[model samples]
Target chain A: MTDIRAKLRGFVLEELVYCEDPDTFSDDEDLLEAGLDSLGIMRLIMFAEREFGITLPDTEIEPDMVRNFNALTGWIESHRQ
Target chain B: MQLLEDFLANLSSHPRSCCLVEGGLRLSYREVAEKAGGVARQLLTLTLPEGYPVAVALPRGIDATCAVLGILASGRCYLPLDLKAPRLRQRWILEDSRAVAVIGHAPWNDLTLPWITIDTISPTPLEPLPLEMENLAAILYTSGSTGTPKGVALSHRAIHAFSDWAKELVSLGPEDRIAAIAPLHFDLSTFDLFSSLSSGASIHFLPEGLTIAPSHLTAWLSDTAITGFYSVPSLLSFWSWKGNLSASPLPDLRFLLFAGETFPTARLRQLAGYLPHTRLYNLYGPTETNVCCHWPVERETLDSDHPIPIGYPACGDRLYIAPRHNELWVQGPTLASGYWQQGQLHPFLNEEGWYQTGDRVGRNDQGEYVYRGRLDRMLKVSGHRVEPAEIEAALLSLPQVIECAVVGIEDWEGIRPAAAVVMQQDEAIPTIRALLKRTLPTYMLPSTIRRLDSLPRLSNGKPDLVSIQAILTR
Candidate 1:
């Protein structure tokens, strides 16, 4: 899970264009409040699907599941086959 | 002036109709009129001369709308300074307009003019002042390439004519609930604020801080029962790409109008697929002429993948093509008076009283005007002039290319055309480059074709040229 969190942060900076330092976030910080918009969420979801082979449920992906780094990683860990 | 007077009179009659909604707060037309009258009475207390420009620096919401109408009722024109712009930019606009006062509650103690706080105002009945038809209504500043923003001075006569035409063209009525998506400073806001106000329709503003949140935005659209949507193409693309459009279609939406920038054909097709019931329109114009031409998208044309024609001239405007270069020149009552700088008229107007649009266009086989590119965007490469849009169109024809922006970068070998491309999923960059080499002419091919995750966009969602240049140099 720690490795997944680090990889997710790397993708957030490079692909999502977060424009923030990687070390600025804690595990449970609100990513949406910290400048992670829906555009970033979409990109991150696609990245998770491609990299980890975890298919996020298209209709059931509530915004709360991606609210923070911990929630995102936990959701992916639960869903990955 | 009579049209405006009648519109205000009608609003005063309909007291219970919802006039605006912002930040989870809704106000009726009667309440808004009274609030505006209160501000107008306060402006009278300031004793500023008629026709003076007053700056409104509030956020895009109900208070800002009331402030503008109040200033207009006080027989003074209002300038909306975008609060989110750089402080230097806001100050430059305030200095250039030489405004008498700024009405807002934002904390930045840099103003030399008088300030009127939006919170301190109280509602009172005030009679509207009589004004001439040619009185200056608003001054919208466009970003200049040379770093100095040029103010486009529009008159009451111009907006009245344009809004009257728009109200009829879109068949707007009191039943329409128009979305106020654009900022107050953008020219698209004119339609959102005035046209809806004139027709007694409700203007629903997306709440502050939630505009870019697609889930919240989609939910709000359905919750508010919005009937008419107006925005730039970039916002529409973002909504269709990232928002839950397919999962929950907005059943109440009837029309989707976009302007202020070019809408890529692929994105438009995707949106049309998402909302098959909604009618889509592509409006074209600069800030000088507020939406001169428009195209109503047809189902057949969407499949052809041809660049959408800007369509016929609306708002009683006349379009003339330059014989040599086919540059579009617009002439009509809707044209802005001129660029304002220190009370002097700039050279935007020609000897024949037409605003040179600087857009190169030509009539296609169907007798519709097709946009080629901007005349100023023409670049010379290898002693041959190449239009970047031509190259972009060719690249977009390839199945792998989803979006592309072509710009000219200066090198030791003079100006060279470079493309920043966003490809479809899993498509390789080299495939697009090889496809472009086979399809385009040798001189028209981009010297450097770079793939990007996304194009850097401005606050208004148009592609940022300075950022594109930075990427090219890097």
Candidate 2:
């Protein structure tokens, strides 16, 4: 399985084109204005769902909430409850 | 001629006029016409269904401009799908409109349609725009929250009527180069594109992401030598607050047009002082009816202590207020055929063929309509009739808010009016709330009044209510 950080790093690196390692990018970086499009969140959705065997609801995901590496992962952690 | 016919006729008369511009790039009238013509020839070869909506999915700019003209010239209706909107939005437009084909670039190659990737940046030149005004010109898709995006069908006649009034509204001539601000998907672009072309004037399409920045907007206004600019009040307010237009070189732009929502008197005053003689016009209409009413404002009207009236209906059209300040009804040549997937026409349009604008409006003593707010937005909170527009209007009248939106939410507690506001820089948020208490009833005073950095807007220049809801909930 892909390490979650690697997965996050690769996704951000590929799309945003700049910036560095996923370990450095926190979970709270507002991704909407952070050069990441919603497509970045979409990729994260499929990755999290496939890895955790849980479905992410559209109502739960929005452009404003998923701005950084930490926020996307945090959303997953909170939803697990 | 239908709308396309009028454009084609006008384009033929002035072949050398600058039709599309981006950065240093420019396309003349003859060049655009030839490209659209070639596209028309190619479209004739396709096995398209009659009344088929050809999806033009691209960001607004020079390429999308030509694509729209080409779709009309090809004798097919074009549907502008905002590339910046969510993929679901793009997919929704195609599926709902049942588009037969799409004209896009390589980046959008994966979009589902009988796709034609026409790259204007390549060495290939554009063909002429095809079609008469009698044909379907474009099918514009406007999305409502919680449902599929509905396509508004406009024939050549609708666009013609709109452009005819638009050209007349501004009296645009060859020397009048207007700054094209809104995206292709937005109807506001009608003036800059068709109206400019109709009069052999130039359209300088600003580069993507240039519309928002205050500094960038000021630079474009001066460098492009734009005679006029069209925008919503929010943007105009930003330019005014930044004091970017204070310079002489920064376009004492002849005309400033505001639509989509009411222009606060504060905003109007700031802009009016900057460009003293500039004709400030307040245009009102929904996408369903194009522009049905216009109120040309002088600085004098702004001084009056009344709700700013939206002015009189222009073109072959008229506006009427429903009884008791209910729905606003519009009738005219610019009325769209109906929503593409329309099960029923807009509820406001009764048997008489008037477009029912869900917008609620009241009239001043002069019999001019003062736009109150959307009738559909009324809330039955705690068995009480609550119109957010009322609260917003009162807040705006208080001299603090540049613009604001009042939304109602019913949680476990009770129903309450929650306001999200954008304030003038010198003003404090607490002072606004204090003022609201003095003027408004206790129940009417917003339980939660929050200030936003800036209100988000959809491509159509209206507040992004969905995004706003998210912001408030967060």
Candidate 3:
């Protein structure tokens, strides 16, 4: 299994924030509050699935996930195999 | 029915005014009529069965709207075919509508329909057709993101009712210059263009793909001095995302109409704090019923639990919700001709003539209906039926929650419901994953709780499901 949690953290930094490192972004940082917009979220979804081969189902695709790295990782960990 | 003709006659009176603006082109009512007349004369020459659809697959602009009017003036129903989408999607629309003729700047791709290019001839002024109230005018194809797009056939009387109803609500006149923001193919823009022109109100067209960027949007709003504008909730929310309403907004902007999606009460409240002086309204309708209902979102209503009320029917419109469900059944003078090609996929309404809107709605004591969500969005869990909207509502009720979506994911055994959420920055993101469990049952808990920086929205400003589906497909 791909480390869904670690992969999600990396996605937040890479696809979402373009952050230099995942450590800088917290699990709670508001994607909207931290300057993430709709366009950015769209790109993230495309990136996360393609990069990690993660098939995000509709129920799992929350609008809020992009708000923070911690939230993204939490979702991955909670649904871990 | 005489309004279109009267507007044509009054075209002579507005000589000095700039009527339509696209790219480098600007046309007065005279110029518009002249160019459109040139097209209409040629279209009138074509020998097609009455009610045969003529599709216009092209970029939206003054030319596109003119093409539509010309097709109708030639006594044929105009079918809008946007060239920007996938060609396959366009082909599906063509197959469904059985269009006989297409007017576009793009090269004719279809093997069957005759393509008519209007720029070939010099301008000739058009004469108004003797149109009846029941005469078929235009059939608009809506983005059936949930299913295949269907054509909504509207009549002259239905069109007239929509225009007059809007005019009554806004009390607009020749003095008001409305800006066209929606793609001509979108149902909301249908009203924006026709309702404004229903009277002699001048229309200002935003440049193609103009509002895609924020800097350009603010500049265009300022440059055009637009008095009124219609947009989707997602678009409006985007403008206010930075919470910059007090910043140099369009000084002349007054009436702001939004439709084609659900508007969360929280976002509306935030908008009120920003644009305190402007009037915001939520117009409701399916493509099938042009805009049958409306609810004016005043600053005061923002305080209610669910402030966005889909108000009373306009003109001869009626709305009745199904018992214990959110689906609203509508019957009105302005209803469309039914899905393209597919005559009767849904007869859920009744012999009395009400069409069921798959959306869920609730009525308050005043008989005002508040939209709940889609009926199908409710999912069946392990021996339990649950509404994702309920969980979403609970999430939003929490101060930390910003926006959310719930979907049901199937596993090896059965199905599980989950939620994706966007949150405010001040809150710890990791904590929320654990926090939501308290508010929801174990089975009801989202299997995954991903956060998004932003949500993908459709052109109509509703959430984009295709983009969402792409994530899962990947």
Q: Candidate 1's residue-wise lDDT over B285-356, tens digit each? A: 878888788888876787776777888888889999998888899998788888877544465789998898
Worst 10 residues of 1 chain B by lDDT: B378-387
Tell how far residue B470 is off in model 1, in angstroms.
11
lDDT of 2 by residue, B161-245 (tens): 8877878888888888888877677778777778888788888876654433454567767777888867766556655644356
Candidate 1 residues lying further than 4 Å off, grouped into runs, are A1-81, B49-51, B343-347, B377-474
Residue-level lDDT tens digits of model 2 in A1-81: 235546655655433322334345555666555444322344455556766667655334554445566666666666666
lDDT of 3: 0.65
Instruction: Tell me the lDDT of candidate 1.
Output: 0.75
TM-score to true structure, per model: 0.76, 0.69, 0.68
Q: DockQ (Cα-based) per candidate?
A: 0.18, 0.02, 0.04
What lDDT would each prediction earn against the true structure?
A: 0.75, 0.67, 0.65
Q: Regarding lDDT, does 1 or 2 come out ahead?
A: 1
> Which of the two, 1 or 2, has more DockQ?
1
What ranges in model 2 sit over 4 Å off? A1-81, B107-112, B120-134, B248-252, B342-348, B378-474
What are the fnat scores of the candidates, in the order listed? Answer: 0.05, 0.00, 0.00
- Residue B194: error of model 1 in Å? 0.7
Judged by DockQ, which candidate is best?
Answer: 1
